[model samples]
Target: MLNGHEEQEGVNKFEEKDGNSKNYDESDATVDRHRKILHTDNLKLQDEYQRLQQQNNKLQLLLAEYFQRKKCESRFSDECTDEEKERCYHNTLAKLKELQEECVDQKAHFEDQLKKLQEERQKTEDMVETELEIFVVYKREILLQTMKRHGGKRVSLEDLDRLQQVEERREKELARVQLENIKLNMRFSKYQEKFKAHSIGVDGQHLIDYEELKMENHTYNEKIEEQKEALQKVKKKISSTTHTLTQVKEKLEFIKAENLVKRGSLMKLEAHVNEKKEALKNLKQSRDSLWLDVKCLRCKSGLLRNVDLLQDFEDHCDSNDALKEKLDYLKMRYVQLTQNCREFRRKVQYAKQT
Candidate 1:
């Protein structure tokens, strides 16, 4: 009887121990389920964050590229040569064409990515909703069981506050993400507007205008060259004329000096001729006196007949006539000299006037 009682007591103890172990196993399983669900939610949030980060990076890169291109254009526009500008323009045009093609490709790629992201977001949202529903159901069951065990006691106020805080944090994060998405969309719209503007015929029109301007520039350059050549010829002619004028001025000075010397000599000759005329007048007066003396002697011939004295008187008269003829010849020579001098002076004056 003692042995049977011992055996029964051991069996009851084993059954109690098994029941305790089963309860512990059940609690561990519930904890593991909650942990797994939280881990999956965290992973989904991380993936979404990563995707947004990648998109932001892409947008930033594109913006940087655009700003760099604008800076290059502004720098080249400031002070480069026409050839450099033309080269830059062609390069810019080629780059723009490439960028346009890239933009088209990127637009298509972005559209596809956006569609994919939207679908993924919808799927994630559905999954989160289902998970939330399951969690709610599990929480309700736990709460009911706790209430039954604790005779209707509510959860702690601190726990409720903590949950509210978590919910607020989640809402804030969602709002931040939505704002970022809006900013990205705005940037994309701006890029599209830029692309559209570039797609117009502005480049073609500019090319046509550039060609016309080049033609005009060539023509203008040719005209400038011709003008320069004509100016050179005019300058040569002016230099030659100036040299001739200087030579003529030198010749005129030499001729003027010669004329002055000749004028001085002519004046001296005129004075000498006037002196000769005065001398001739004195000689003529002397001859007249001698003739009167001769006449007086002839009247006294009957009172005193002296042949020698008459003959001497006749010789004196003949010598006086010869002296008078010589005076006449000198007077004619003086007149001729005066006439020649006057003629020479008149010719010199005429030459000076001319």
Candidate 2:
């Protein structure tokens, strides 16, 4: 009877341990399932973020294109024909209307999406809080059962440490997830603000009165006609100026060639004057020697016999007069050349300024 009781007690303890182990396994499985669901939610959020970013980029591009088109239309308004301008204006109006409609649709869709996200966030929060509470209660029950089985002895230090560590990790993870959700909400709000701004800009155009736009259009047409007339006059003036410029260019080229020839002639004249000066120096020296010879002859024989000396003196005087005239002519020519150079330079400068 004593052996049987001991066996029964051992079996009961074994069964209790088995039940505890099974409960732990089930709890672990539940935690793993919750983790998987959270992971999926994170992935979905990431995908949504990427999608929103892409949409934002596309919207920015469209807005930029719209502004560029508007600028181009404004620039060409005066240049375009009346019919073309009207067509462009109609097209722009049509596009604006379409964009307004699209904005309305997008706004509605975004509002719906926002509402859905809010509801989903609330549901997720509620579910997570409930699950956490349940998990805590389960843990407490397990701890109590463990203590009972151990006869109220202190729980193992390693198990207590592990439980504390797991709870800390879970709390940290929950905080991180909450932070992420808050950040996502902030981003959504920013997107909403942007949408509001866009809608306001689109609607602002409606404030302009139609009568005022018509009057402005009429004034623009009158201005365009005036501008066209001015442009035609400018074109005529440009053509006349171009013809004058071509003629001046031709004259400048001719003057440059003539100046080159004149410079060559001036160079030749200078060389000739140098040669003449050298000849005059030689003639003076010869005359002086001849005079000395005549004086010596007169002193020795009391008379001079050479008649060529007087003739040579006469010829030297004539040559000196000719050289003086030639030098004066060269000086006049140099002055004329310099004046012509100045006049040509002035004309070239005037042409360039024009």
Candidate 3:
């Protein structure tokens, strides 16, 4: 009775092991299905990452092309950079400053020359007045001498003639002094008019030119600012693209780690399942051999009424058939899942292309 009880316990333990192995097999199949799904998802993510990279490259190329076009089209900045703009502005400012300085210098030069001319005119007028005083003194002396010689009597015609000749000479000297004064006044007037006209025309024209330069510079600055804004927008787009790519890469890494773990677990489960199958096969073979030996003994002894061994063996065979059916169902489900994943990938690709 104890032997039969121990044998029954062993059968129960074997059934429990078989049931546990069946559960493990089912769980492993589910894990494998999930792993495949994850693998497919990882592939999709990689494809998306590649597409984003391509888009980023295209954006970069477009940005480069735009910058090249701007450079070719621009007239202000040489390199289209901020420093270039500043340098150009400085050069323009320097030119304006030089022009202003030149105008100031010219005005100063004109003023100095005018002051010298005025001083010379004043000197000439003083010299003319002194010469006239000397001429009057000489005439008075000659008349006093004539009066002394005649002694208040009638004067000689010859003496009167001499006075007339001296008078003529003094009048000629006065006329020459007046002519030089007139010429000096005319020259001063001409210079003053020329200075006035030059200042008006040159200053006005320079001021107009400077204003035009400023307006052109203003327009150039506006264009530069607009280009800068455009560059900033492109940079933002590139940054966003890079950020998305980084996220995808992280996701791919996570998927790879998960795949490694799942692969390890699947291998372990497969090893366990194979061990269980070997054990079951060995047990079935031993049981069948024992059953044959017992039948041979019973037939030889003429005691062929025992059918428990055959019935027990048939029950174990039926259990194995049920397990095989379950395995087949799981495999069919895995195949369906793989098909579904493939279809999903195809749909995604089609959508992206459209």
Candidate 4:
């Protein structure tokens, strides 16, 4: 039973480690995959950029030539003789044919480049998938090696804590690396967008032959008619806008007049408020003075006496009561003496009579 329990404990420990290793391995593989993808993407972009830059330069030169020709024609159109005009016209036609041929060649070349890029992307995806599988197998090998090294013993909590601390430090380093990766990704994305925009600017989807050219001319005429309609609409809009502006101007003038009247009324109200405030101030001052006079009257009328003096007056009243009691005793003594004297006199008379 004890051996069985020990084996179970070992299995449980192995399970915990397997879970951690799996998670860590998965994360590492993802990071590696991202790295490889970015590297391949960068290579692809470099090649594409070189090609596109060359094409752009050629297109720019062609555009410059055409524009230069147009400028020369405009400058000399009135002065040039018919033979010179005919020569210039022939030269222009030849240049146009050459430009059309170049355009066709470019379109074909671009199609080939597109095919190559698609194949490369597919190849890259396949390579990444295979590499991922290899990485997973490599991760498993490392885990097996780790298990061999650790043997069947259960990992202690203290050891796990130490490992967790180590992992935290590693995570900090990983985070810094991820930050740099993110910055690089941002730059890459910006470049990608710029490349896309550049490609759009020089798009090859235009009239390639005489029929298409004629269709384009017809479209231009239709566009001109649309523009004329748009211009009429704009004129109507302008007239409506002018009417609204006049109404706005009239309303503004009315508002300004009303504002002036309001300002006059406000000024009057403000003056009245100031007068009331001054009156209130005067009233407050008067009330304060009256309070001071009332306090002085209270003091002078002896309504507010000192506590010690009141106590002394009470003591004096108490002494006066004691003196009054003594006087009443003395008067009683005298009455008693008078009554005794009368009795003695009566007794003496009785003795004499006997």
Global lDDT of each candidate: 0.59, 0.62, 0.56, 0.61
Q: Model 1: which residue pairs collide? A: none
- Give the winner by TM-score: 1 or 2: 2
Candidate 4 collision pairs: none
Q: Which 10 consecutive residues of model 3 have the lowest summed lDDT? A: 144-153
Q: What TM-score do all the candidates reach, one by one?
A: 0.27, 0.36, 0.24, 0.30
Candidate 1: list runs displaced more than 4 Å. Answer: 1-88, 153-354
Ranking by TM-score: 2, 4, 1, 3
Kindly list the per-residue Cα lDDT of model 2 for residues 182-255, writing each as its tens digit: 55544554544444444444545423433444455566556556655655655565566457446644654464
Stretches > 4 Å off in candidate 4: 1-45, 69-73, 137-354
The positional error of residue 199 in candidate 1, measured at the CA in angstroms, is 33
lDDT of 1 by residue, 1-354 (tens): 224345345345434543454554565466556545644654455455445445555654565667677787877677767888689679967976886687678667866766766666666566655655555454433333323322433543344344445555554554454444444444444444444334343578656655665565566556556655655655565566457435644644454454456556656777898899999999999999999998898687643577777788889999999999999999999999999999999999999999
Off by over 4 Å in 2: 1-24, 81-87, 110-114, 117-121, 144-162, 169-354
| lDDT tens digits, residue span 216-247, model 3 | 55665565566556556555655664574466
Overall local distance difference test of candidate 1: 0.59
By TM-score, who's the top model here?
A: 2
Pick out the ten consecutive residues of candidate 2 with the lowest summed lDDT. Answer: 144-153
